[model samples]
Target: MLKMMTYFQGFSGHQSVPVTVDFPRSPPKLPSTSEAESETSMSEASSEDLVPPLEAGAALYREEEKAAKKKEKKKSKGLASVFSVFTKGKKKKGQPSSAEPEGAAGSRQGLDGPLPTVEELKAALERGRLEAARPLLALERELAAAAAGGASAEELVRRQSKVEALYELLRDQVLGVLRRPLEAAPERLRQALAVVAEQEREDRQAAAAAGPGTSALATTRPRRWLQLWRCGVAEAAEERMGGRPAEGAEVPESVFLHMGRTMKEDLEAVVERLKPLFPAEFGVVAAYAESYHQHFAAHVAATAQFELCERDTYMLLVWVQNLYPNDILNSPKLAGELQGVGLGSLLPPKQIRLLEATFLSNEAANVKELMTRALELEAQRWAQDMPPQRLDGHCHSELAIDIIQIISQAQVKAESITLDLGSQIRQVLLVELLAFLRSYQHDFNEFLERGKKLRSYRANVIANINNCLSFRTSMEQNWQVPQDTLSLLLGPLAELKSHGFSTLLQSLCEDLKPLFKRFSHTRWAVPMETLEKIIATVGVRLPEFSELQDCFREELVEAVHLHLVKEYIIQLSKRRLVLKTAEQQQQLAGHILANADAIQHFCTEHGSHATWLQPALPTLAEIIRLQDPSAIKIEVATYATSYPDFSKGHLSAILAIKGNLSNSDVKSIRSILDVSTGVQEPSRPLFSLIKVG
Candidate 1:
C-alpha cells in the first residue's frame, strides 16, 4: 500500500490523474517585438510596421470632397437667381464646345490614321502614362466608323490597317513590360515583389529559429494569415499621384493591386503593368490552394494518409502560401454597389482575416493525430507489454522533442496563423514522456527480486535511479520553447524521477522485513558487520537519495533491536542452572553482561538507531541477574506484567536460567500470574496465547 501510494503521488509531489487535453484558445499572436533581441529571432516589428500609407485613402477622400465643394460653389456663384436658369443653359451649351476642338483635332488626323507606334504604347504603359494612349484609341474608333460607312480609299485602307495592327502590338508590349525583371519593374511593382520576397526571407528565419522542435504546421488550422509591411514605395506613389485615380481618357487605374492600407494605393503602375496579364497568374496561384483544401478537409486525422500529408504535403502548401498569401490576390474586393457609389466609396478597409484559410481546416486534425499517437504509444508500451522494458530514453526523447519542435515551429507561424493547438501538443508530450518514465516500476520489481545479493541489488537500484534522474536532467537542460509554454511542459519527468527514488527507499524497507527473525537464540547481539552492511544500502544510492538516510537507518536499528531482545529472552531460558552456588551464578551472569556490552558498543559506534537500547539493556540485565526464587518470581511477574504481551515461557525461562525456583516455586509463580491475569479456567496456562520457547 505504501508503494502504491508512492506510485500515484510520485509525479506531482501530490496526486493527480492524467487528463485528456483540450486545445487552448491561442491569444492573438502579435509579432514579438522582443524577438529581435531574444531567441525568437524574428525581425523586429515596431508599431509603425502595420500603419497604412497615411496619404493613401484619407487624402483622396478629402480631395473628392474638396472637388464636390468647388463644383457646388461654382454653380451657386455663377449668377443672380433671376438669371441662374439662363446661365444653367449656357453652362450646358459650354460643355459640348469644350469637346469640339478635341474632335476637330481627331478629324484632322483621321486621314493620317493617328496610329500609335508599338514603341509609343509600350513606353507610355510602362511609365504608367495612360493619357498618351487615348489619341491612338480615338483614331482606331474613327477608322472603324469610316470602314462601316463604306468609305475606303488607298490611304484610308492603309492607315486603317496600321490602326488595326496596333491592338496586338500594344498588348504584347504591355505584357513584355509586365514580365520585365522585377528589380527593373516600376516602383509599385517592385514594392509588391519586395514585400513578398521579404516575407519569404522572414519565413526562412522563423523556421530555423524554431530549432529542433517538430514543425507545428501539422497541427495548424488550415487557415493562416500573415501581416505584410510597406517600404515607402506605395506611399511615395500616393504622394506623387495626389491620391487620385485616372481611368481611360486619363491614366487607367487598373484595379490590379490595391494596397489594403487606409489610403489604398490603386497601384497605377501595377495597373498599367499587370493589366495585360494579371488573370493568368491569379488562376495559377489560386487553383492549387483551392484544390488541396478539399482533400485536406475530407480526410480525418486518424488515417495514415492524413499523417503523411501533415508531415509532407502540408509543409509544401505552407511554403506556397508564404510565396503567395491566401492564394487570392490582395488587389480589391467588391463591397456594396447597389446604386451610385462615387469613386472612393467602394474603397474597402484592409481585410483582417487570416492571410489564407487554405490551411485552417486541418489544424485540429493534426493536433488530434499528435495526441492520438502519444496516447496509443503510451497504451502499447505500458499496458500491453508482455514483460516491461526499460524506458528507451533516446526514443522517448526524440518523440518528446518532436512534439516540442512541432509546437515551436507552429509558434513561429502562429504570429500570423493564430494556432490554438500548440499548448495541447506540449501537454500531451509531457504526459506521454511521464507515462514512459513511470513504467520503470517493472525494473524496480526485478531489482527487489535481486536483493539476496544485497550489493548487486543496491548497485542496480542506484544505477536505475540515476538513469531516471539523468534523463530528467537532460530534458530540463535542453528542452527549448517559449517561456510561457516551457513553464507548463517541463518538470513532469522530474516528479517521476523523484517518485522512482522514493520507491527505491521503500524497496529497501521491504527487503528488511523478515531479516530480523534470523537473529535467534544463540545469535545475541547483531554483528557489527551485519548492521553496517544493512545501513550501507541507503548510502550506495546517496546524494540523490541523501534525504532518506535517517528514515532508513532508524528502521534498521529497530528491526535489529527487536530480534536481539526476542532471541535474548530465549537464550536466557537455555542457560544451565545459575545458582548451584554464587560463583556459578556470577559466571553465567557475566557472560550475558559481556554480550550486552558489545551491543551497546555497536549502537554507540555506528548510528542513532541504538539510542533505544541505552535504558532497555540495563533493566534487562538486572532482571536476568536475580538468583532468589521469590525475587525471580517478583521480577518476572513485574516484567511480564509491565510487558503484558510477554509469554509465560519468557518468565519460566528466566526462572530456569537463575536455577532459583523448584517446580513448587514455578507453580506458585504461575498461580500468582494466573490471578494477576484473571485466569478463570484451571487447565489453561497463564500465557497460553504466546508462542513461548
Candidate 2:
C-alpha cells in the first residue's frame, strides 16, 4: 500500500511520470470461512473496480507534459526571431555577423594585416589612425595579462615579444608628436593625446578592477607617456639651440636670438593650436614652457662653463637675463599663455651668479681694453698732427662717446638681468673708467706740452677738455658715482681743464705782454695808442672763441677778463711814477679810465659775465684822479667798498702814486681804509691775483 501510494503521488503531481504499473495477478481468494471474511472480500473488489486503468492515466500525463514543453519551445522561438530582426536592422551595412569564422570576419573588418612594423605604425599615426591602433594596444595588454597569468615559457616570450613591439611603436609615435607638435596634424596631435588619456584611463581601471595580487594589475604598464612628452619637448628645445657656435665663428647674439625665436614660435602654436585640442588637466602650454625652460637652462649652464670670449659671455647674459624673461617667456604673444606655469630660471641661481661674475670680470677687461684703444686712437690722431674734427664749430672726439657707450651698455645689460648685477658692474666699470681717466690725463698733458706749436694743438686741447666734461657728465648720470670716486675721476678732469685753459690763455697773454710792458706813469699821459693796440689784439681772437663749447666759452671769457684786469693793475703798480701836479694826476686818471672802458667793452661783447671785475678798474681810476685830500679819501673808501680784495700792499702802492699828499694826509687816507671788516671775498678775486711786490 505504501509503494502504491508513492507511485500514485508521483504520477498525480505536476511532475511527468510513466503510468505503467504491475498489479497482483488476481485478488487473493482469501478465507471464505466466515460471513465477515466474505463481506471484506466484496469490499476490496469494489475498491479495485473504482480504480482507473494504468495505460489511460499514463498516456494522459504524457500528453499534458509534451504539450507544456512544446508551448514553451514555440514561445522562445518567436522571441528569438523578433530579437534577430531588431539586431540585424541595427547592424551596419556589410558588417559581418558574430557567427562568421574569425578569419573571414577579420578580413572584412580591415583588421587583418601583418603585425604593424614600427614604420607602418608611424605611417598610420601620421595619418591620425589612433582609433584604428587601439585594438592593437588592447591586444598587447591582453598578451601582458596572459603572460602574467602563468603562461608557458615559450608562450610568454611570444606574447611579450608582440607586446614589446607594440610598446616601442607607441612610444615612438607619442614622442615624435611632442617633439614636432607644430609639424604634426592638429587632429593627429589630438588623437595622440586622446590615446594617452585612454591609456591612463585603462591603467586606472585595471588597477581598480584587479585585486592586489591579481595578474591584471601586475601586467599593467604605468602609461608614462605624459612624462615622455616632457622629455620630448626638452629634446625639441635642445635641437632648437642650433648647437654651439662653429669653431671660428663668433658666438654672436643670433645664437640666443634663434633659440628664443623658435621657442616662442613653437610655444605659441601649442597655446593657440594644441591647447584647445587637449583637456585642461593636460596643461599643454605649461608643459611645453617648463620643458623648454629646463632644457634651455641646462644648455646655458653647459655653455657658460666653457671658456667663452667677452662677446660670447655678453650675448649669453643678454639672452638669459633679459630676452628670455622679458621678451620671450613673458612676451605679449604669450602673456596669458603661461599664467600658471612656474618657469624656473634659465640657469640655476648658483649658475647665474657665476655667469654674472664672469660677465662683470669680462666686462671690466673689455672696458679697459676698449678705453685704452680709444685713447690710443686719439693719440694716433694727435701723432698724425690731425686736429680733432669739429662738430658745429666745436672740437669733438670719439673718446667720451665710445667710453660712455661701453659702460652704459654693460650696465644696461647687467641691470636688465638684475639690479645687484648692475651695481656690481657699475663698480667694475668705475674702476676701469678711473684708470682710463688717469691715462687720458697723462696722454693729454704730454700732447699739450709737446704739441704746443702744432696747428691742431688748440683744437685737440679743447676736444680733450670736452671729453673730460663728457666723461664726468655721463658717469654722474649713468653710474652711482660715490663722492670719493667722483673726486678721483674729477681730479684728472679738473687738472686737464686747468692745463688746457692755461695753454689757451698763454697765447693771448703772449700777445698782450708787450702791450702791457709799455704802460708806465710817464706813458700813461700819452695818446691811448697802446690801449687801442691792446683792444685790437683782443678783437682778433674774439671770433675764435666761438669755437669753444658754450659753458667753457663763458668761463674762458671770464678768465680772460680777470687776467687782463690783473695785468693792468700789475703794470700800473710797477711804475712808482708820482702824480705830483693836478694835471699829471688828472691825465693819468683819464688814461686809466679810457683803458678800463676798452677792457670792459671788449669782455662784455664777447660773452664775459664778470660784471664784478668791471668795477675794479673804474673805481681805481676814480681814486687816482681825485686830488683834494678829503675827496681822495672818499674815493679810496669807494675803491675799498667795490674791490674788497684790495689789500694794504695795494693801498700803499696807490698812496705812493699820490705824490702831492703830505705824509699826514696819506696817513689819514690810509687810516680811513679799514681791513678789519669781515667782508666776503670776491668769487673771482683780481687784486688777490695781483702781487704788489
Choose the strongest candidate by TM-score.
Answer: 2
Clash pairs detected, candidate 2: none
Candidate 2 stretches greater than 4 Å from native = 1-192, 202-225, 228-258, 380-427, 452-494, 504-508, 521-523, 527-529, 540-557, 575-591, 622-644, 658-682
Taking all chains together, the TM-score of candidate 2 against the true structure is 0.66
Error of 2 at 42 (Å): 83
**What's the distance in Å from true for residue 274, model 1?**
11
Instruction: Tell me the TM-score of each prediction against the true structure.
Output: 0.31, 0.66
